[model samples]
Target: MLRVKNPVLPGFHADPSILRVGNEYYIANSTFEWYPGVEIHRSRDMVTWEKVASPLSEKRLLDMDGALASCGIWAPCLSWSDGLFYLIYTNVRSWNAGAWKDTPNYLTTASSIEGPWSDPVYLNSSGFDPSLFHDDDGRKWLVNMEWDWRKTGSHQFSGILLQEYSTEQKALVGPIQKIYPGSEIGMVEGPHLYKKNGWYYIFAAEGGTSYEHAMSVGRSRCLTGPYEFHPHNPLLSSYGHPEIRLQKSGHASWCDTPDGRSYLAFLCGRPLPGTLDCVLGRETSIVELEWRDDWPYLKPAPGEELFPSGAVRNWPADSFEPPVVLDEYRKKGEFPPATKSIEYRFDGSAIHPDFKNLRTERDPEVYSLTSRPGFLSLRGGQSPVSHWGQSLLARRQTDFSFSAETKLEFAPTSFQHLAGLCWRYDETNQYLCALTFDENLGRVLKVLTFVDRQFMHYDPVPVPGDGPVWLGLTVQVDSGRFRYSPDGKTWRILRPVLSAAVLSDEFGGMGFTGAFTGMFCIDTLDYTARAYFESFKYTVL
Candidate 1:
């Protein structure tokens, strides 16, 4: 069952920040490492939205020379103050490095919703997820997730802090003081403070924005004093509810529906059975807000909402049917033509280029194939980031267990003309079960499962010798096993190692990652003599 409005927006959209100017509205989400930072979407009603401009489209604003997929952009908050709109976020060099180890927080502004935004003003590094909270007294507070890096057996850099903003200097005015740390409230990031019922309420994320995610709240009589975690905390979350389709629903920011009615807009990483992974990052979602006895609560009101069912049109009939499932190549009469083209979009990153989203830069001569022209092919990535340099025409891995099948023609050669399906999460994670060509050995199917920073090869299975060979994969995750096949029907099982990190919530964030997104995938060949997709298919088992 899918929500009609499920996925709201696709392709790595995350870290939603909304601002109401007049009758119209604007929302900004983090666009990490991608050349254009902070994508802005405009909407009149709470529903429909269209892309505007990246706040850092100007060269003076920010630079992302070596930004990784989930790094460059941090939590972004959008607010309109004094006829000016502001986008507040942190710019990190790379997630592989660690947050704030390099670039710090910054702010950019524009006059109109669509803008040539102003250059950035550096903010402080004691926090991330920089948000603008304009008080009634005309003072604007810049609150964010406080960052700490004390290594006491656990990983470094895990704590929350808060501070005040200096609009004149475009920086933090006073020394940042710790608001209640996330440990105190069972959450750690995306902190926002609002006033209701004479008490200051704090909304934060817990479980590090992944599968075990939740929206927690606490209140304080003072803005920067002792805060109390709600008795019924995780106000708007499915923390322990396995049935909820919304995974890692945190880093929340709240907006109102005019007339003073409040609502919350946050990003959610929708998990599919296969073909799509959470690494595509997060999608934006909306929920109503209400106050009980003066304290604010996230939508569905404490034990009252359905998982993945928060839409006006959530009936299965109203939603788009899921894509056709495919597991093998060469499926005789039951299959599509040998080749078809697909259309896709990219955030201008080296992984997924701006023009073609289907395929990305895999090697010097090829990129990952997307749906372009009539068929997708490899075009070498001019720009490279991490190990994603391999041309991969991939879609997100939605289901844990499913089959990915494709057709490729390989010429017997020494240099590997790589073609096949892959499961990827970031530069260091994932695996490839592929068809590699060798002059002597001919075309053969293989399985390579990567985990714990190690790529282990399973037994190589030979396929029938042909100019073009069929390749298929059965990556069954529910049982924690991955297999491969030559034809689309039969399969071979490979042993599994625990790859919890790829399936966890901490890795998801903006621009397909900020808070949630799909994993890196490719459908292109590297160092190819020539290869063709008779057809490509992914099926959820």
Candidate 2:
């Protein structure tokens, strides 16, 4: 037997849709406001996974220009049938507007996972979290959660709708039906349909995506009729169990092994030691399931307790308790080892697959690897807060304690030309240690921070010459500080320690993504200034 750690895919991977083709398993995750809409990882043994593709790579398939923070792609569903892979996703134009949400869902297909995928076909904007179900009768159907913005709170998630999709016409046809209205646990979404043992089952996410989140199931003998809820409604949840290492556990997808074992892939968050802040974001985890009396339930690992009381109990609607911090919970070795270290030399022809840009695809006008051989050349564009063309490349900050170092060769004649390293959560919340120009000093290094829309600038240190300079940032749990080095060996502290807690989902309030650390260049003056980054290195502390 193989013992697998939780969160096989870490750092911002959420809303997993798992599918198996032949002997290979694939999991596609949502990428909110980041470009390359969906993240797909593949695994052969279910214990180790590697990123294989990001399907929505072109702007034609996904256009998210000016998309606000946490408002882009929601839950993406990936399925396979007839030697073709189907991908369905939502492009949320606006979600924060009062009593209204513009969520337009679309569908795209590819013969292979790593594709030249076809342009997306527009589906319905009536709701989000769309799924494709290929029935055994050689017919296809689409199911999605209907959003009623007129209603408030949990009522906004009205119900799940089902309709037949014509493969030949490439569009939805026939009458739509409300298959399942959802259980008493409201805020239903992320619907997935499956067939097992002469029964059609529908699984959905309920109780919002916060601490009270859970996965509920219902089954029906017929395809379109009233469904019966499970005897134990919520199939899986960590609602009141604050002692568990994984929190906000729900939004699941299912698959089976060739050996006849069933497994579930769900999204979970690991909050900071003493806070409800998940700085690393929601991730994907897998667990085995056992069937009893035609109903499925989680199978606890050896010597592990499935529930706090050793038996499942019905939790009240308002049973959400304040999250408790038990640092010892993670000491049981449930989490995967932290990423030790990585370095990028920019010697290759393309950027590493681990890096991602905000809201837009990688534009050649902003970044290039061939422009300055052996170095990444970034032609500065707008400021960091702009949703338009911003020359920033970053990777997820996976560990609580880590250090990032980068060497930048930039000659800035004005304060508008800035280049350096950044620890960013979104446009509105971030910390930057940049090298720019000063009126009194020719060239200087400074640290700037923005938290909850408030900005602050630290004192600047003058540099003697205009050559390259190394910038460094070290984050220790709740706080972070910046440093600089003229020579690669000697380092000097550049500023006072600032609060790193602000770079989290809890502090940002309206954000759903995690923090990232990388290099950036901003030229608000002319958008023509260029910054060359020699190298970048990150190490987990």
**Which predicted model would earn the best lDDT?**
2
Question: At residue 395, what lDDT does model 2 achieve?
Answer: 90
Q: Give the residue spans of candidate 2 off by over 4 A.
A: 152-155, 305-310, 313-338
Global lDDT of each candidate: 0.55, 0.85
| lDDT agreement of model 1 with the native | 0.55
Please give the RMSD to the true structure for each candidate, in Å: 9.5, 5.1
Best by TM-score: 2
Poorest 10 consecutive residues by lDDT, candidate 2: 316-325
Q: What does candidate 2's lDDT look like per residue over 1-541, in tens digits? A: 2245566777788899999898889999999998778999987766557889999889999989999988899999999999899999999999877778899999999999999898898888889889998888888889999989779653588999999988888899999899999899898899999889988989899998888889999999988868899888799888988877788889999888777778888988888888888888887887777787777787766655546476763221111111121344336534235255889889998888788888888887688998889999999989888988889989988888899999999999999999999999988899999999998998999898888888888888998898889999888888888999998779998776877678877785756778899999999998999999988998989
The C-alpha stretches of model 1 lying farther than 4 A from their native spots are 1-14, 23-27, 30-44, 47-70, 93-103, 112-115, 154-168, 195-200, 210-212, 219-231, 267-284, 298-378, 381-422, 432-437, 441-449, 456-541
> Deviation in angstroms for 82 in model 2?
1.0
Q: Residue-wise lDDT of candidate 1 within 166-282, one digit each (tens)?
A: 776666777667776664435377777777666877887766556555667788888886888776666655455445566556667776655776766766765544423464457
- TM-scores, all candidates, are 0.64, 0.94
